[model samples]
Target: MEAVVERFLKYIKCDTKSDEETGVTPSTPGQMEFAKKLAEELKNIGMSNVSLDENGYVMAEVPSNTDKNVPVIGFIAHMDTAPDMSGKNVNPKIVENYDGNDIVLNKDQNIVLKVKDFPEIKECVGKTIITTDGTTLLGADDKAGVAEIITAVDYLIKNPSIEHGTVKIAFTPDEEIGCGADHFDVEKFNADFAYTIDGGSVGELECENFNAAGAVVSIKGRNVHPGSAKDKMINSMLIANEFIFMLPDTETPSHTEGYEGFYHITSLKGDVEETKIHYIIRDFDKQKFEERKYIMSAIVQSLNKKYGEDTVSVEIKDQYYNMKEKIQPVKHIVDTAFRAMEECEVVPKVVPIRGGTDGARLSYMGLPTPNLFTGGYNFHGRYEFIPTFAMEKAVDVILKIIELYTKA
Candidate 1:
């Protein structure tokens, strides 16, 4: 069997960084290249109906070996890494039998993964852990997920004696920028239910995620000579800063957790001529989510009233909503995951996702897709790492879910 760790190490080297500015599906050429490679891999692994679509969505089917009819299940993961960090030229370091000490990721650069900052590293004791060299993200956000699903399917195909039902697998692109399901052909995929193997840590099963939206504030200001700019000049950069400050300071991502919603400022860039601030609004409550958008719009209006009419323009677009509503109607799907986790001896962590996932959007698209873990931590950053054992365990969980589904 191909090791999940080996697959992850190889997949992360592809430099599949998604670009939000791009209009095309997959967003970047690297994603398309990666998808093609993965599609070929699926075919080589004996998966049927293996296809890499124009949008870089790779879908494959694992034919059922059982005689009785069983519901088709799908497992999904994203191919693109977050735009927040560079996924290029990644150099991974392995720590064997981690002793729970501070790991120095780059000795020359003196970059260390401090235990104090990330105490969770202690949990991976006596296991092989993979980490970045402090120069780039590990891309474990969903690559680990990709590896786990593939490894599990490979195991199923190799062990045809282990009775199982039809299983579908999908690898999506541009999930980080919130367009993963925008072009998803759920009807064609033909799954009764699905799970996105894209969560953090082991044994995480998430059905609830944030109700999300994006707010873009465009600030236009007049640049004048500092010598006589007192009343004549309007500093749009300052106005942008004020617009951000107008939002409640305590309601930001850093200040909230565990069912608490947040207003995350993703980017702020500008000069006096023009400034654009990008923010993502999230909430678990539908009403609160709407209120948050209202607050953002009200702030933009107040800034416009202060600066001048049309000086500050704001655009708020609704992203994915909480999947709880969709998943609740099919709660047994979550139950099956919990049972599968127990069978795998993985203590299930049923938590609400603070951020959204491709599964959340897919759930609303008529697929009650929950989320599973990749056994990774500190995702989308330099400190990102994953335990080899945890990743192997994820493969086991996937297999267990397939087995449990056949019994059902």
Candidate 2:
């Protein structure tokens, strides 16, 4: 049992699932608990200036060991899991020396990880893999990242001869709910650039992510008696369906892929008198992103013209934008990580993030952070799993990135 794996297993048990409805910093108590634990671990690992803020952000630093002037680098990972699934009592099952076949996560529940469904698992044929027991999510989304960063720092602390510059690390809460960077004290962390270890799969290096915005469409209708409901009564749900149909059916999360943006209707709730439809609009291109938002507004306007004014109201808010605009100015930060991956014998797979990470917002906040992989796949769900060897490789990559900076 490697230290990273041990840490990951221990951390997931704390159940730090985030909720947006709470309207609080951590959004849940478990996140604060997890933050305290991580803060204690940082102190025990010999990190300096360790601090856990009220908002559940844990920050610490590894003091520079060499005489050469090196830029302060930051590594970050979120603490909370997504609200999509249960993170409580996460029972992880390890498949030792995987034989490249279907893995039965839970026999009673008949839950299986089939190769046909996820052909990517075939890549882990001869390696050890960690998966959930089909009931709760395995918190590898960013927990694997948290473990990798801590392990890398621990290694650096033990091996004092491997001189490196100041390294800052932070574990944020509510990244799953888009509030990871809300209270980040960037000036205090004080890093020239950062890399978020929150990406999926091995060798993934992402500098671009979707320009994201969230839209809420609320509908009001007039309800009448059943006998008088012919023309007098208006069904808001029917109008909601019309709005849904207005958007291009082909342009959705299921239908779109690789650099193609989509309009995802996350939730729809309403009856006759009132209804609310929640949407998340995403696009990698700036123009397309604005167009997507415009499309939603246009539909609302069109619906209002037919159903009557004030019947359909939509509120769209910008969440985060593409980090490429900021990262392009400091391209060498990406190049350094790319070169480090190659040196570690890991194939570099540079791709645009279909989804956003804390790095996306941090870039605009003057951190110019890019994303690095945690070697985990199928994030935010029960089928989430990560290869142990890949985790080890990620640790190697992190150390290599630090070493590369020292050499510069």
Candidate 3:
């Protein structure tokens, strides 16, 4: 739909970038503003039971046209853009009939999205592409997914002749901070199985994701005089550095890819007296994931043994686990997504997610959820771009999944 592109452009202009430091659910007030607009748009498209929560979760339903006992399916996407890039005043440029050449994102900044850097741009061929202007993220990471889902639901509502089961849709906030499903009322939404349309590229259907956790390593030191008392003064910052070095440097996010796990140092700050190192650990394998956390705590324990017992404290909190454990029991849900892609002539790229999704947490919350593609590329960055043709295909994939479910 031409309206989908227009809607995406309007949505990105809302400046819905999430704040990691904020304790609030949506994190930014702009997210709430965008959520409200999306809810209104969902209602306008004639979705049933359209509602928004106080915490900024929007859910709507498209009732089944068929009289069969088919399972109610849900589609989900996050509302907030990544905080790593600016979402403020995102000026989207439409590249019609993508010529497969390097297009300048900003002539003033000398920013060019090169074909050499991203050869995948060649895949779009003659398709329309929406990209940022080098100043802000395009917000297509999940907004494109969101727009695709809503557009599909709208299509289903308009064409009542297309026999399908009940469809549920949800728009969530704070997914960038990894708490998208923290306040999600899954039971209230009431779908047997759901799919989060948050994948990076087209043909993506990821049921397995990283088993994740966050670690806060606090290093305490005795700061006497650095010049006069050498033995009495302990540099906490140096100890923090030492602690970071204990983990395998090769396992960092920058170094690792695919299913390989990493101990990513997210933030580091300290002085001579006190220092803190924040880390996020990720692994796809359950046993390996546990071992990674255990190894981290052991490193801290060893440091504490050398120093005082409480000198180095490691506080590790489990964020979310791989959805493979939860989705394995309901394997057919994954198959449904797979067949949906194939039926739409989109090859199924069933890969393990290197990162976590709201679906990962929702699966553990008693819903077997997987992820689908929205045709976004170079997400959460200024170079972020999306193929409009791929997004239009996403709409087909969603409806196809619903059709496959009912037929099965």
* Best lDDT among the predictions, by candidate number: 2
What does candidate 2's lDDT look like per residue over 126-191, in tens digits?
A: 999999999999999889999999999999998899999999999999999889999999999999
Which runs of model 2 end up more than 4 angstroms from their true locations?
none
TM-score, cand. 1 vs. native: 0.99
- Candidate 2 lDDT score at position 388: 96
Clashing pairs in 3: none
Give the clashing pairs for model 2. Answer: none
- Determine the C-alpha RMSD for candidate 2 after optimal superposition of all C-alphas: 0.9
- In order, the Cα lDDT scores of the candidates are 0.93, 0.94, 0.90
- The TM-score between candidate 3 and the true structure equals 0.95
Where does candidate 3 have its weakest 10-residue lDDT segment?
A: 2-11
Off by over 4 Å in 1: none
Screening candidate 1 with a backbone cut-off below 3 angstroms (N, C-alpha, C), the clashing residue pairs are none
**Distance (Å) between predicted and true CA of 149, model 1?**
0.7
Model 1, 35-95: lDDT tens per residue?
9999999999999999888899999999888898889999999999999899999999999
